[model samples]
Target chain A: MARKIDPDQREQHKAAIAEAVWRLVARSGLEAVSLREVAGEAGVSVGRVQHYFGTKDALLLYGLRLAQQRMEGRIRRRIAGLVAPGAEDVLRATLAELLGDDPDTRQAVRVWTAFLGRALDDRAIAEALFADDVELRAFTTEVVGSPLDAHGLWALANGLAAEVACGQTTAADARAVVDHHLDRLLGSPDR
Target chain B: MARKIDPDQREQHKAAIAEAVWRLVARSGLEAVSLREVAGEAGVSVGRVQHYFGTKDALLLYGLRLAQQRMEGRIRRRIAGLVAPGAEDVLRATLAELLGDDPDTRQAVRVWTAFLGRALDDRAIAEALFADDVELRAFTTEVVGSPLDAHGLWALANGLAAEVACGQTTAADARAVVDHHLDRLLGSPDR
Candidate 1:
C-alpha cells in the first residue's frame, strides 16, 4: 500500500529535490550528486528520491533541466518589468544575468561550469546540456535582431559569469564588460 | 640510498606527472583527480608521486600551473611564427587558442573548467586561479591598447571555448564568432 501524492505535491517535492541538487553542485560540483546525498540535502528519504528520479543520471538530468527553465523564467520576468524595452535593452538585460551578482545566479553559474566539466567526459551530459543551446542561441539572435554574432554574445556573458563565480572579477566589472559589448554590437554611443 | 636526479630528468618527470593529471581531468573532471590515480596514470608508483607533488592539492595546483605555462608557451610560439604580427594579430592568435580545435587545447580547456568547478567549493583553488587572472588580464589589456574591454574579450573567447569543449558548437563556428568580435574590436572592415 502506497500513499498517493497530488500533482502539486509531487511538483513541490521535485522542485525541492532539484534545489538540493543545486546546493550540492554549488558546493562540490556535479560529482557530489547522488540519490542519498540529494535525499539528505532535501530532507527527504532516499525512497522518496528513488520514487521520483530513478537513477543518478535521471536525477541529474532533471535538476539540470529544471535549473535551466528557472533561469530562463527569471530572465523573462525581469525583461517583462522593463517598461517599453528596446531590442538592445532586452539584449543587455539578458546578458546582464551573466554577472552572477545574486546568490542564485552564482550557484547556477557554478552548477553550469561543473556541468561543462562533466560534459567533457560524459557524452550523455554533453547531449543533455547542449540540446537547448540551439533554442537558446536562437532566442538571443531574435532578441538582438542585428548582425552581431548571437552565440558570441552568449559566450561572452557566460565567460563573465564564470569569472564572477570563480571570484576572478567583481559583478560590477562583469556588468561593465557586458554593457561595453552591447554598446559596440548595438552601435550605441552611450550606455 | 638516494640517487641524485639531473635537473632535466626531474623536470621531465614532473611534466609527465602533470600530463597524466590533464588526461585524467579531461576524462572525468577534477573530482576524479587523486594522488594514486595520477601515479597510476603516469606509470609511476604512489611514493614517487608523493615525492614529487607532496599532496593531492599540491599535485592539482602544480598541474594547473604547468598547464597555464604550457598554454602561454604554445600561444607565444604561434605568435612568434607570424610574419610582422601586429597587436591585433597577436590578440587574434591568442583568442584563437580558445577554439579548442586541437587535442591538447581541448584537454586543457576541460581541465580549466574542472578547476573552475572545484574553485567554487574550495577557496584555496579559487585563490590560486584568481591570482593568475590579474596578470592574464593585464597582458590582454596591454595587447588591446583600446577603450574596448579586454577582460570581456577574454571572457568571450573562454565562453566559446567552453561551447566547443562541451560539443555545443564546432571549432569553425567558434573561430568565426571570435573573428567577428575581433573585427568589431579592431575596426577592421574586412575579414
Candidate 2:
C-alpha cells in the first residue's frame, strides 16, 4: 500500500531516493541497484519508492537521465571556463577534465560507467547517449580542425574514458593519448 | 525439494543453467539475472539450481569464471593460428582478435562487463580481478618492444577493447591507435 505524501515532501523524498541510488551505483556497480535495496539504504519505505517510481524500470530511467544531465552540465561549465581558447586547446582541456582522477571527476566517471552498462540494454538511453557522443565528437573535431569522421573521434574519446575508469590509465597518460590523436587528425606535428 | 539426479545428469543440468544465465546476462545485463529466471529459462526446477550452485551468488561466480576461461582460451587460440610474427605484430594481432566482433569474443566481453559491475561490490572478486589485471599488464609490457610501461600498455589495451565493444572503432582503427601509441613511446618522429 502507498501513502499520500505532501508535494514538497515528495519532491525531497524523490531527490533523496535518487541520491541513494547514485551512492549505491558508485560504491558497487549497476547490479547493486535495486528498488528494495535502495529503499532500505535510503531509510525510506518501499511504498514511498513505489509511489515515486511506480516500477524499477521507471526508477532506472529517471536515475540515468539525471546522471546524464549532471554530466552535460559539468562539461558545459568546463567549456565555458576556457577563455578565448583555440578549438584544439579547448578540446584537450575538456578531454583531460573528463578523464582526470579527481574525486568529483572520478565519481562522475563511475556514474557514467554505470549508466553505460544500462545503455547497452536500453535502446532509449543508448539512442540519447549516441546522439550526445556524436555531438561531443563534432565539437572535438571542430576544435582540432580534424577531418576525421565523428565515429573515429568518439571511439577514441570513449575508449580513453573506459581505460581511465578501469584503473588501467593515469590521468596524465589519458591526456597524452588525446593529444596524440588530435595531433594526428589535425595534420599538425607540433600539437 | 532438491532432485536426486545422477552425476552425469547433474553435469548436464549445470551446463544448461550456465548457458541460460549467459543468455540473460548478454540480453539484459547482469542486473536482470535471477536464479528463478535462470531456472525458467533453462526449463529446470528452482531446486535444481540450489542443488547445483548452493546459492545464486555461487551460480553467478561460476558462470563468470567460465566466461573468463573462455576468453583466455580464445585469445590463446587466435595467437596460435598466426604465421611468423614479430613482437609488435603479435601484440596487435592478439588484441585485434580479442576485440574483434566475433560472437564468442562479444559474449565474453559482455559477461566481463557484467561481472565487472558486480565485482565493484564483492571484495573477493575485486581482489581477484585486480590480480588478474596486474598479470595481464606485466605480460603485455614484455611485448610491443617495451614501448610502454605496464600500466600504459594495459590502459591502451583496455581502451581498445571498450572502443571495439561499443562499435566506436573498427578493427583497423583500433590497430592504428595501438600503432600511434607505440610510435610515440618509441620516440619515432615518423611512423
Candidate 3:
C-alpha cells in the first residue's frame, strides 16, 4: 500500500527545515546554509527538503518570511491582551518586542542581518525589505505624530536591536532606552 | 642582490590588501574573504599578505581599525574646516561624515556589519568592537549633555547608517533625520 501523505505533517516538515536554516545561520552565518547541510540538520532526506523549497534562494526567502510572520504573530498576541491599549502602548509593546533580547528576537536578528547583507545584492529582497520599512514607518508615524520622529524611532529601535544582539547593551538597558525615547516622543506619564 | 623594501611601500601594500578585503566583503559578503582570495584581489603573493596579518581574524581586525581611523580623520578634517565650531557643529560634522552615503561609508558599513556577525562568536573582536562603542558614547556625551541620550544618539546614527547602506533610506534623508535629532538634542541653530 502507498504511504499516506498528510498535509499537516508536510507543513511541519517545512517548518522544521526553516528552523534548521535559522539554526545554521545563527551558528555559522548565512554562508553556511546549503540544501545538503540543511537536510542533515533537519534530519531529513535532501530530496524531501528539496520538494518544499526548490533553491537556496527560495529556502532563504521562505525562512525570512516565516520568521517575520512569527514575529508579527507574537506582537499581535501581546497587543491583544492589553485592555483598551493606546497607540503609545501598542507602539511601545511592538518596539519592545522587536528589541527584546529573547531567543526568538536573537534568532530573528541573526536571520535579519544576514538577509540585509543579501538584500544589498538582490533586487527582489531589497524591494521586500524596503516595503517592510515603509509599512513600519507608517505605523510608527501613527503613534508619534511626526514622520521624522517616527523614522528616528524606527532607526533607534533597530540600532538597539543590533546592539543588544551583539551584547554591547543588555536587554534591560535596551528596554529602558526604548521607554525613555517613547516617553520623550509621546509625553506619557512616567511608569 | 636583496630587493629593498621601503617602509612607506610596505605600508601601501598592507593598505592595498585591506582595501581588497573590503572590496571582497562588499561584493560577496564576509564569507568571501580568504587569504588566497585577498591576495588574488590585491595582486600580491599569498605569503606577502600572510606576512602582514598572520590570520583571517588579524586581517579583519586590521581592516576594521584602519577604516575607523580613516573615518575619524575625515571627521576631524571636516570639523577643523568649520569656523568657531561648537560641540554641536563637531557632533553634526562627525555624524554627517559617518552617515555619508559615499562609497567609503558604504564599504565601511559592509565591512562593519560583516565584522558584527563575527563578533558574536569571537570574544576578542567583540571586546574590540564594544570598546569602540564605549569610546563613541563618551564623545557623544560631551556633545549631547546626557550620557543616556548620547547612547541613544549613537544607536540612532548606527541604525541610520545600516539603513542607508542597505538602501532603505537615502543618505540625504538620513542626514535630514540626523539633523532633526541633533537639533532636538543640542538645540543648535538651524543651518
Which candidate's lDDT is highest?
A: 3
Enumerate the candidates' DockQ scores in order: 0.64, 0.24, 0.51
Candidate 1 segments exceeding 4 Å error: A1-4, A31-36, A143-148, A189-191, B1-3, B130-132, B189-191
Question: If the candidates were sorted by their lDDT against the true structure, best first, what order would they fall in?
Answer: 3, 1, 2
- DockQ of candidate 2, scored on C-alphas against the true complex (2 decimals): 0.24
Alpha-carbon deviation at B103 in model 3, angstroms: 2.9
Residue-level lDDT tens digits of model 3 in A1-191 = 99888989877888999999999887777778899999999999899888998887888888888888888888888899888998778888888788775688778876776666677666666665556678888988997888889999889888887777666888789878877777777886445
lDDT tens digits, residue span B9-122, model 2: 776778789988888888887778888899998998999899999988889877777667767787778778877765655666566766676787777666665565555557
lDDT of prediction 3: 0.80
Q: 1 or 3, which is superior by DockQ?
A: 1
Model 2: per-residue Cα lDDT at residue A143: 61
Task: Rank candidates, TM-score, best first.
Answer: 3, 1, 2
Fnat values, one per model, are: 0.79, 0.22, 0.39
Candidate 2 vs 3: which has more TM-score:
3
- For every model shown, what is its TM-score relative to the native structure? 0.89, 0.75, 0.91
lDDT of 1 by residue, A1-191 (tens): 89786899888999999999999998876767888898999999999998998887888888888887788777788789998887667767666665746678778877877777777777887777677667767867886663347888888888888877776778887888787777766667354
Top candidate by DockQ: 1
Deviating ranges (above 4 Å) for candidate 2: A1-16, A36-52, A144-191, B1-16, B40-45, B127-132, B145-191
